[model samples]
Target: MARIGVIGTGYVGLVTAVGMATLGHEVVGMDKDEGKIRKLKGGEPPFYEEGLEDYLKRAMEEGRLRFTLSTEEAVKGARYVFIAVNTPMDDDGSADLSQLLSASRSIARALDGFSILIVRSTAPVGSLDAMVEVMREEGKERGRDYELAYNPEFLREGTGIYDFLNPSRIVVGADTPEVAEEVMSLYEGINSPKLTTSIKNAQIIKYASNAFLAARVSFINEIAAVCEALGGDVWDVAEGIGLDPRIGRHYLRPGPGYSGPCLPKDLMALIRMSEEYGHFPHFLEAIHLRNEAQKRRVVWKVKEALGGVFTGKTVGVLGLTFKPNTDDVRNSISIPILRRMSKQGARVKAYDPMGGENAKAIFGDAVEVYNDPYEALDGVDAVLILTAWEEFAKLDWDRIRERVRRPYIVDSVGIFRRGAPEGWRAWTVGKGDLPSPEVSPESDV
Candidate 1:
């Protein structure tokens, strides 16, 4: 079994550490956050991911995984060191590589033997070259001391563990075939397609993948708008278009646009990188602008449902995270939507099955976060569904109908496209009219 070191211990790094350990490798995860390290040492995951705690505890019990704050301890005697640090977007839309570069420098300083430093962080195309330069500044020779490779992660937040173990494809980018093969060996137990190429291509692969997915989301959302205008259903439209073999049925669901950490950040970073390379990415820029407009459209829907004004209205939000099954609120479309509603004199009551605390911290006094979904809906003018949590679909809508001032729903995520509770007036994306007056007690479409 190969000895592996994972730096950063954030979403990406922690998953990699545990995944590799589960594959029978001795792994160490390093992070500067004392509280996070302490939690991991006690079999606690700092964030929510399905099956992460079970796997973490199992790996620790098997003596294959451990956590530490010392970079030296993480990389010492390790043959493969994965750099999975955060590359947050800057105010100018470029990826701030401060944390990534710092991790590289630390690895360079702590190198005890020849190790392959595989970058799993989402970065711009020439980031590996910058890492080489950083290590060179630390008096480390590239060939003799270490090698660099790019192995970008494509794990989603909620299903990171499952995605890691059952990846569709694995791409390793290195200077030589031997280096690529060495890195690919780490995942030999997993049966999947593996590709090896230049580091630049691997980096572009990651950014391009995210940008394309975001484009698909924005594309469908725009189509949803068009469908609404033409009195057509986006669900049928997306299905008809997605049936084409070239366009598989994925990422076509329309909502408040794509808002997770990776899609928005990577799309912006790719746009910045393209501009730096003397290319204007018009399509990419439009996709981003469209996503922003989609969020505003959701708020506008809420206002329209409440008689064109947010003043003296209560909006009970169903979900806050970007998506379901994760407790992450960073870059969630709900944040901007909630902030806009609260700013416009609307009382916002929000709840999430998992993201409540994180969303509460972010919204503060602006939003009244509730633990109970039914309580949040009490005396509300309209219910806004942002994240598509399954529980929201299974909510006791009959109970909700009796509590709310008005049984109005702005279903941004289309959770009620199939049908909402009887006697409820709802505005669903892509669907022109829903819950007809004949089927409901009140008639407001």
Candidate 2:
């Protein structure tokens, strides 16, 4: 079994450490966060991901996994050191490599012998060069002291562990074919297509892949807007086009545009990276602008539904996370949408199965986050479904209708495919029917 050190125990690093341990490797995960390291040592995950706790427990029980606060202890004598630190988007739309470069410097000082340092973070194309420079300042030379490789991770947030264990494909880029092969050996038992290429290509593949997915999301949102105007069902349109072997159905479902830790940041980074290379990516820029517009469009739909006024309205929001099955609210679309509504004098109440606490922290005082979905929906002017969580679909619409002041819903994710409850006026994206005010119960007399 190979000894592996995974630096930065955030979502990617934690999942990688556990996944490597599960593969029978002796893995040590290191992070600077004392609290996070303490939690991991106690077998408590800092964040939620499906099946992560079980897998982490199993790996720890087998004595193949451990956590540490010392970078030197983690990387010393390891065969492979994976740098999975966060490369957050900077104000200038480029990747801020501060954390990554800091990790590399630490790893350089801690290395005992020749090891393969694999970068698992999503960064710009030339990020490896910056890492090499930093390591060189610490008196570590590449090819002699350690080998560098790019192995970008493509794990989704909610399904990160599963994605890591059962990846569709593995791409490893190194300076030499031999070095690439050695890095690929880390996943020996996994039966997936492994591609060995240059570092530049690997980085591009990572950026292009996310950019393409973001583009697909923006394209579908634009189509959804068109459908709303032309009275065409985008759901049907997406399916019909998706069936064409060239286009897949994934990322075609329209909602409040793509907003997550990776997609938006990566898309913006790519746009900036491309611009730095003297080529303006009009298509990518448009995709980004369209995503922003889609978020605004959701607010507009809510405003129009409320007779063009948000004053004194209590908007109940269902789903606050960027997606379901994860607690990550880093760049959720719900934040901006709700903030706009709250600023317009609307009282915002929201609920999510997992993201409530995080949303509460972000929206503090502006949004009332409830543990119970029903409580959030109680006595509201309108209900907006944002994240498309499965539980939202099975809600007691009858009870909701009774509690809500007006039976109006702006279903951005189209959770009510069967149509809203009787007497409810629902405005669904990409649907022809526009929501009309529900007639008061006394009007029936």
Q: Model 1: what TM-score?
A: 0.96
Worst 10 residues of 2 by lDDT: 436-445
Model 2 misplacement above 4 A: 434-445
After TM-score superposition, the amount by which residue 79's alpha carbon in candidate 1 deviates from its true location, in angstroms, is 1.3
What are the per-residue Cα lDDT tens digits for candidate 2 across 1-445? Answer: 9999999999999999999999999999999999999999999899998999999999999899999999988999898999999999999989999999999999999999988999999979888999999999999999999999999898999899999999989999998999999999989999888999999999999999999999999999999989888878888899998998889788899999999799999999999999999989999999999999999999988887676788888999999999988999888999899999999999999999999998888888999999999999999988999999999988898899899887889899988755877778788888875544434422221
Please, what is the TM-score per model?
Answer: 0.96, 0.97
lDDT of 1 by residue, 267-337 (tens): 99999999999999999999999999999999988887887778888999999999998999999999899
> Model 1's lDDT to the true fold?
0.91
Error of 2 at 427 (Å): 0.5
